[model samples]
Target chain A: MKILVTVAEVATVDDEFEIDGTEIADQYLNADLNEWDDYAIEEAVQLQEGGVADEVVTVTIGPEESEQTIRQALAKGADRAIRVWDESLEGVDLLDVRAKTEILKAVVAEEEPDLILSGVQTGDDSWMATGVSLAESLDFQWSAVVNDLDHDLEDGTASVRRELEGGVEELSEVDLPAVLTIQTGINEPRYASLRGIRQAQRKPLDAKTLDDIGVDAGVVDGSLELTDMYEPESESDATVWEGSAEETAGELAEMLREKGVTA
Target chain B: MTDVLAIADHRRGELRPVSYELATAGRELADETGGDLHLAVISGAVDEFGEKLAREGVDVVHTVADGEEFNHDVYVQAIEQLVDTIDPQYVLVPNSVNGLDYAPAVAGRLDLSIVTDVVDLAVDGDSLIATREMYGGKVETTTELDAGTALATIREGEWPEAEGTADASIEAFDAEIDEDAVGSTVTGFEEVAGGDVDISEADLLVSIGRGIEEEENLDLIRDLVDALDATLSSSRPIVDNGWLPANRQVGQSGKVVTPDVYIAIGISGAVQHVAGMKGSDTIVAINTDPNAPIMDIADYAIHDDLFDVVPALIEEFQ
Candidate 1:
């Protein structure tokens, strides 16, 4: 069985990070593997390690630095990595849901893996629809926000339990070659050990552009655009307590008492 | 005139509260864009849901009785037909699990500009701008659709629930879905859980976050819990790390707790996490970051490390 895991590099910026022209301030922008994708990678690697699958391939649509994010996945035990990058994709506004989804669709057409894993959402877009949209466009059987997943290689099907709001969970099954959006906390992601990190340096890290992947550059049009970004209006007026830890705790306990929280 | 179409979401033949919430939010979008509000519903039987939509002040309920349950292809096909029939400038959907599952598919098939989990919506000139929280709700981004026909999923709890007036029209639309397009079969749902600990009922919750540092540090928190006689709970990090059970998780995906006292230690209040516990009578935050979002909702926020605050709090309570 071959499992395809898609990951993306997300920006880590301060709460006050402001948009400078079309993009945010450069100084506050730094990149890391999307936090939610770590769970996807970990699930894929665990499935592979448990002998439930023969291979685990990770893919991403990102810049040159994204190869590093792919390497982090490999360090956690992915067999290889594929990076989809184009100079035109460098523009912040160019790569929208359509562009990203189309890119993944193209890659999936090439891989033809039995199963696909994607993060439920991203810290950047927080859109919560890319994985679902990609699966839909590909016409693949799919499930989303899955917290528990188990596969049967012999039967060529997988059953998953999805986490829902208010502590409800939905259980369903899909045939093999399906896409599943993995929810976080299904399992703890492992750190890259010294050997794994060193081995990742030598693993196959393939980079493909739009033309190389047979995707047109016109998907940027009719895409969702970030017209502006700013902080939301403050809805609270919290009182800050300033004192030593000892005094502060006493004050908090007293306040809780006043509010009838505890006596 | 342009209109915004909202699809009512239902589970097990029952309409969800977010069904009205999305309609409420969509009513504003319709009013702002000088468009009427239309609601489309897909279910094997949506008679009850259809009547509710009418009372919610919707201009029309484009009701479709295709599948008793929500099938991916059924919803995708139905919403596609509804969009074509209405030609609404904006398609507003709820951000529930079932809603997110097929909303994207319809948006993709219709080639509409899709936005998921939007908290705010506005009309800037001819463009439709949307605001959504990101980075765990620490940052707010205002995004716009480059085209006219756009799709968005309204975040639940961000908008008010639609009030009912029982005065609206209903329309029936048929979705042409090929039987072959239904790729997967539902083999009945198995309730994998029940009888587990329900943390939402806890009177006092002593919650910890990444600032707890390690699993061993839970002992320090345990001491405080013992002093305050509070139930031990945590945000996603501790729960993800297996330091706490999944039921103990207090966040959007977890249980919503309205404890009398919620002492959040080291938890940076992400919007998702706050959604579950903002109703607590007293919320105390202990974190080094003075600007943590949790601090905003906290009645008494201590700008100190958890390691320093937990021990002192335990002693004070004792």
Candidate 2:
């Protein structure tokens, strides 16, 4: 079996905002790996260790710097890596969920992986829906926030455990050739080994563009447009109450009531 | 006039509050866009559920009674069929687990633009602007959709419940689910047991984080909650350390709450946790660290040890 993991690099906001008292582009621009992507990579590695998959391939879409993140996943023991590089792909909102899903669908069509795992949501775009979107695009069985997965290759079925509200757990079984979005805390990610790090540098990495996947960036353009980006106002006035415990409690309750918080 | 479809999420024969809120939001959007509101219910014996939705300003309720329980494919097919029939200007769903699944699937199949966890929605001329949190709630970004039709999965409690009567006509729609579509089968469900109190539904919540320090100190906070008859919840770290169950965690990964009174005990208010409870009517933070993020959002801040502040609050409430 083969597993595919997709990661995206996102931007962070810095203190220096924009010219109009809004945070500037620099303030709005910090880049990092998808937090949940790490979990996806870790899960893939675990599957390989358990012999559920013979190899794990990591994929990412971003500018050139994103290769560093993919390499990190390689260091974490992904067998190979693929980077879909396009400078214009930066700052694209998740409104193109279908378009991205199509691109992923095309990748799956090419790679023909048995199982695909994704982070439940991305740090940059916490939409938490892309994995399912990709699943539907590929017409594959899928589960979201999956905490556990056990595969039965013979029956082409897999048992999955998902986290639900109120600490509830739901167990379901989906057929193979499925997609799953992994939640955090589902497993402990292993640190990069010295051997894995050295091996990652030598592993095969295929660089591709949207053209390679037969997708035009224009397909996603008309859906959503970034009219402008600005920083949110910091509306924090830290009011400190100083007094005895009883006094503070009385004051707190009164304040809440006055604010119409407590009836 | 276009039609807007709102998917209702129900489990164990009960509808979630977010389902009501999403319906209200959908109705408002439909009104603004000169569209009709259509509610879709998927489950076994969804007639009663469909009727309940009809009262909420929905022009029609579409029911898909194909399964004893939820199957992803069944829901996806039902929603996909609804979208095909309605050609809605907008599709609204709650950003819950079930919604998170089928909403995107429908969007993917229809090749529609989609937004998830949207907190605000408005029409700017012919386009729709959706405001969502970015960087774990550190910033808010608004995405403008130029597409003719857009799909959004709204965060629960973002919109107030609407008041208006509807014809509430219930329509049972055959989803034409196939045996292959129901390939995924639920083996069983294990409900987590502990507090009878549903914190999400609680109007008053007193939540503690790692700031409380020790497991034993939880008793003191419990006393304050008891005195005020307020529900007790906690941050992820508290739950992760086993001081509280995962159900009590108030954060992006846990339960999103908008209580009338949300008291933060020893919680520093990480963005993930704040995103869950910042919508509370009143926020009170008690922490020794004046610089904690929770203090920034608190209506009132007490810079004191929770150990001391809680006991006093319990006594005063009693």
Strongest candidate by TM-score: 1
Which runs of model 2 end up more than 4 angstroms from their true locations?
A14-24, A27-29, A87-95, A151-154, A220-222, A231-238, A241-263, B163-165, B193-233, B237-248, B251-297, B302-318
Query: In model 1, which runs have C-alpha deviations exceeding 4 angstroms?
Result: A14-19, A259-263, B187-196
Chain B TM, every candidate:
0.93, 0.76
Q: Rate the local accuracy (lDDT) of all candidates.
A: 0.81, 0.78
lDDT of 2 by residue, A46-75 (tens): 888887789898777666777777788999
Docking class of 2: acceptable
What is candidate 2's CA lDDT for residue B53?
Answer: 72
Pairs with backbone N, CA or C atoms under 3 Å apart (clashes), candidate 2: A12-A30, A17-A23, A17-A24, A18-A22, A18-A23, A18-A24
Total clashing pairs for each candidate: 3, 6
Best by DockQ: 1
DockQ, per-model, please? 0.63, 0.43
RMSD of each: 2.1, 5.5
Deviation in angstroms for A166 in model 2? 2.5
lDDT of 1 by residue, B1-318 (tens): 479899888876678788888788888888888888998889857777787778565788888988787777788878887887888999988888888788788888888778888888988767878887766665677787765788888888888887857577877777787777776555455432234666778888899898888899899988888887778888988877889877788887777899888989999888779989999988888889877888789987889988887788778766
Count clashing pairs, candidate 1: 3
| Per-residue lDDT value at B90 in model 2 | 89
Error of 2 at A179 (Å): 0.6
